[model samples]
Target: MRIISFQLPVVLSDLDGNRKRFLKAMAEHADDKDVIFMLPEMWGCGFDYKNLQNFAEHTYELISEIQSIINSDTLVITTHPETNQNKVFNTVYAVTKTAVIGKYRKNFLFSPTGEDNYFDKGDDICVVDFKGVRVGFLLCYEIRFPEMFRLTASAGADVVAIPAVWPEAKKDHWQTLTKARAVENQMYVIGCNCSVMHTKKKDMDCGYSVAYDPWGSNLYESVSGEHVLTCEINRENVNDIRQKIPSLSDAMKVFEIKRR
Candidate 1:
């Protein structure tokens, strides 16, 4: 499967402008088929917590607009603040041209960002089959949790997609955790991050959107800017690595023992 990670500089509180930018990005890859496009968390609103409620109100419309732009074979994955039954969630959706294939609400809210105060946590892990490969969805801060990654990989996910709004200060942590998740799980990891720098505050994003193969090798990585990093992912490499290492198979026995 081919994967494209889009590192976009989203404007805070500028929903219309961001949507236009997203559409423009999609246009570049409109004709491409059998590809997965991964965008950063809150790509439409740039982590503007103050206006999250307003954004959540238009989530359905925004999703529909995005869905209209892509072809049937391309799968777009991104996160937005969603309102469901009067409750809000930081949710990621896997969308095809026809319908939404999967949705995963972020379970581990970033306490430092006060996300826990505004959004409800999700209880379920989401894994979807795209074509023949299984893909898992995870939001920004959840990358810090290995248990979630293990659970998704154990569930037969060949690739894990992470949409993030990570700050520049924690770039090292982001890089380390991304590769660690891929290495430990023996699956491909696709991390898409925002590049918009906050001028009024000290907070800025380091846009090193990256992809790691099953052997923890860097397949594609971008510099600190807006970029579309595209690369082909071979599922055969995943099977080969797991067969050679067999780490996940061993870990399953340990998991069963702990359950008892």
Candidate 2:
């Protein structure tokens, strides 16, 4: 399957602008099938917490528009502000042309940025099957939590997509964690991060979109810039790596930890 990550600039609170850029990118790859396209976290509005409700109001419209542009076999993954019961959540959506195949809200909020205050956390861990591939999700801050990823791996996830707005300051952490997730989980890890934002914040959105195979090999890595990174992966690799290492299967399903 072909996995593509859309790394582009996000203008804070500019729903229309971000939507246009997202659609333009989607249009370019509209005809492709058996492909998964991942977008940066909150691609619609970049943490415009003050106007989050307004952004949430347009979430459905933006999704519908994207649905119209993609092919039936194409699956698009991204996070946006979604309102439920008057509470806004950072929701991850896996959408096909016909319907929304999978959905998961951000479980781990970034408290450093006060994300916990603005967004309601989700309780479920989502792992959905798309064209025979078990695709899992991890929003920005959630990547730091290995337990969540281990759960996804144990649940039979072949690929995990991380949508983030990671900063340039911690680029090394981004690189290390992304590879580690793929290595430990024995699955493909695709990270799609936003590039140069139109914000006053110095260099927050450092777009280094990347993909790694189950063997922790870099399939494709983009420099610090706005560019769509694509890599073709074979599902067989996951099986092969698991058979070779047998780490996932050898792991103890249940264990007791006592203070030493």
Candidate 3:
């Protein structure tokens, strides 16, 4: 699968501006088939907690517009604020030109930023089969949790997409954890993050949108600013690595034995 990750600068609460920029950037690749395009977490609005509900109202509209632009086989993954009743969740959606295939609401809210106070967590694991490849999801803060990645791997994921707004201060963690997940699971991992956020107080994100192959090798890595990084990954490579290492299966067997 061809993975294209966009490291965009989020305009904080400016939903219209962010929407226009994202759509314009995606328009060029609208016809690109057999590809997965990844955008940063909360691309439409950067954790604009005060007005998140207002932003959530426009989430479907943005998805509709995105669906209208991309090809039928092009899969786009991104996260945004979603509202259901009185609760709001940080939802990641997997979409194609035809329909929304799957969604994973972020379960582990970042308590450092009081994310748990604002958003309700999701319990389901999102693993979707697109074309011939199995795709999985892991939102920003979720990268710190290895069990989530293991669950996706167990569910037969060939590649995992991580949409993040990771801080510049934790750049090393962002890079290390992404690679760890890929190597540990023997699956492709693509992480897309923001360059900077334009809010009342400008916040700089790590912005090192990167991809790692099953062998823990870097497929693509972006610079500190806004940029688009693309790389082609093969599911056969994942299979080869897992077959050679066999750690994933070994660990699963060990867990099964311990359960008895």
Candidate 4:
């Protein structure tokens, strides 16, 4: 399976600007044959921890207009309108050929800043068959939680799609954790991160976006203020790595859960 990741600069909570950035990335990788595209967290709108009701409602129209422009055979990942129980979710949408195939909502909000205060948590994970490959979805902060990937692997995921708007301060953690998850789970990790500075938030973004093999080796990656990191994921290699390492089987041994 071919994977395309976009490390776009945040448009500073401007949906119109952010969607334009996505069009740019799409133009760059549109010719790549059979590739599934991914964008950073809140791709439609940048992180809006405060006044989410105002923020979420504001972007729907812009998103609908942009959604009309997406061409066929290109799978794009981003967030849009999702109606929950008397509420709307900042939910991620996976689209292809003018159809929204699936979605994954942000579950692990940054509790420190009370992001949980704004967005309601999703009750379930999204694991689906991406054409012929078994794939799973994970949001930004969800990368730090191994349990998400564990469930993905257990559910027979060959590739784990991670879309994040991670901060620059945690660059090490972002890179390290992605590799670790791929290595331990014996599944492909496709990480797409934001690259621009956020106006409301003081910190910058970790713009490095890439795809890692099951062996934990980064096959292709990009470091820039903003970029479209597109590369073909050789699905054949996935089986070979798991066969050689056998970590998935090793995980079947035993473990304990500790509630922090």
Candidate 5:
């Protein structure tokens, strides 16, 4: 199946503006929902980490305007300010046209700007059975942690997706880690990043949206620009790779991790 790893250069705090951009991108790839359509992290607010709570989409009803436009079975991944009990969170929501399947709170929130100031960290990893593909999710910075990747791989994930708002200064880190995750896990790894100028921070958002096959081959990727990297993920390839090396079997003995 094909998957569109969408990259955006979002404008912070401009909900209507960003929605327009998202809809435009979706319109371009509307016919391809037979595959999976994913988006960058905090897509609604670019790198608007500080303004998270200010324009939070406290209810799914509030964003029904956008949700209504999306077709059924489209896996559109994006972040919003979520309310769980009295506490607020910077959470990524996975939405289909009819219902919400699941979400992952940012586990490794970047704090150099005190991301903790606006968002709370999520403790659990979310794995979903999507479109005959076992998909795993992690927000931007979480990809740097090997344990997170291993945890997902252990759960029998064939594909892992990371939605990020990576900065230009650390662009190399973004590319290197993305390829490494695919190579080590032997699963398709997709890294979607923001490609806009940050009004709050000095650095520009890097737009190296990429996809790697189970063999860590760069199937598709772009430089620092706004683009969508679409590629077909063959399940047979994922099965063949795992069957050949059996990294999962090797890892089970060498490293023990609690499975959910």
Candidate 6:
């Protein structure tokens, strides 16, 4: 399967402008099918905590517009602040042309950004099957947790998509963790981050969006700029690596022992 990770400038609190940029990016790959397109966290609102309520209210409309641009066979992954039952959550949605395939609320909200106080935590992990491949979704801060990746991998995920708005200062962590997750789980890892530099604060996202294969090989990596990186991933490589290493299988036994 082919994966396309988009590193776009996310303008804060400018829903209309962000939507336009997103549409423009989608236009470039409108004809592609059977691919996965991943975008950054809080893409529609640019991680604007103050206006999260307003953006969350219009989340459905934004998603509807994005869904319209997707090909029937292409799966698009993006994150937004969603309003559910009068509470708000940082959530990732996996959508195809027709409907939303899966939704994963970010369980690990960054305390440094005060996200934990503003958003409700998700209690469950989610994975969805696209065609014959099983795909999992994780939001920005969730990438720091190996247990979450383990759960997704244990659930049979072939590729894990991490949509982030990671700061430029932590670029090394972003690169290291992305490869580590892929190597540890023997699955493809796609990490897409925003390219926009924050105007209101000292924050600037490092747009080193990257993809790592099962063997910890760098399939593709973008520079610190806006880019659309497309690369093909083979599931056979994942299967072959797992068969040879059997690390996950061995870990399962240790987990069982600890549980007992």
Per-residue CA lDDT of candidate 2, range 50-88, in tens?
Answer: 889998888888889999999888999978899989899
Off by over 4 Å in 1: 197-203, 257-260
How well does model 3 score by local distance difference test? 0.87
- Tell me the tens digit of each residue's lDDT in model 1 across 195-227: 864434655766988799999998885578878
State which candidate, 2 or 6, has the greater lDDT: 2
Off by over 4 Å in 5: 47-50, 58-63, 200-203
Q: Candidate 3 at 228: error in angstroms?
A: 1.0
Tens-digit lDDT string for candidate 5 (115-217): 7776777888878777788888887888789889888888878888888878878878877888898888889988878777455445466787778898888
TM-score of each: 0.95, 0.95, 0.96, 0.87, 0.91, 0.95
Candidate 3: 10-residue stretch with minimal lDDT:
251-260
Residue pairs of candidate 6 with colliding backbone atoms: none
Summed over model 2, clashes come to 0
- State each model's CA lDDT, in order: 0.86, 0.86, 0.87, 0.72, 0.76, 0.86
**Position 125, candidate 1: lDDT:** 86
Global Cα lDDT for candidate 5: 0.76
168-251: candidate 6 lDDT, tens digit per residue: 788888889988999999999999888975657665767888899999988885678888888999888989999999998899
* Model 3, runs deviating above 4 Å: 256-260
What does each candidate score in C-alpha RMSD? 1.9, 2.8, 2.0, 3.1, 2.1, 1.9
Better of 3 and 5 by lDDT: 3
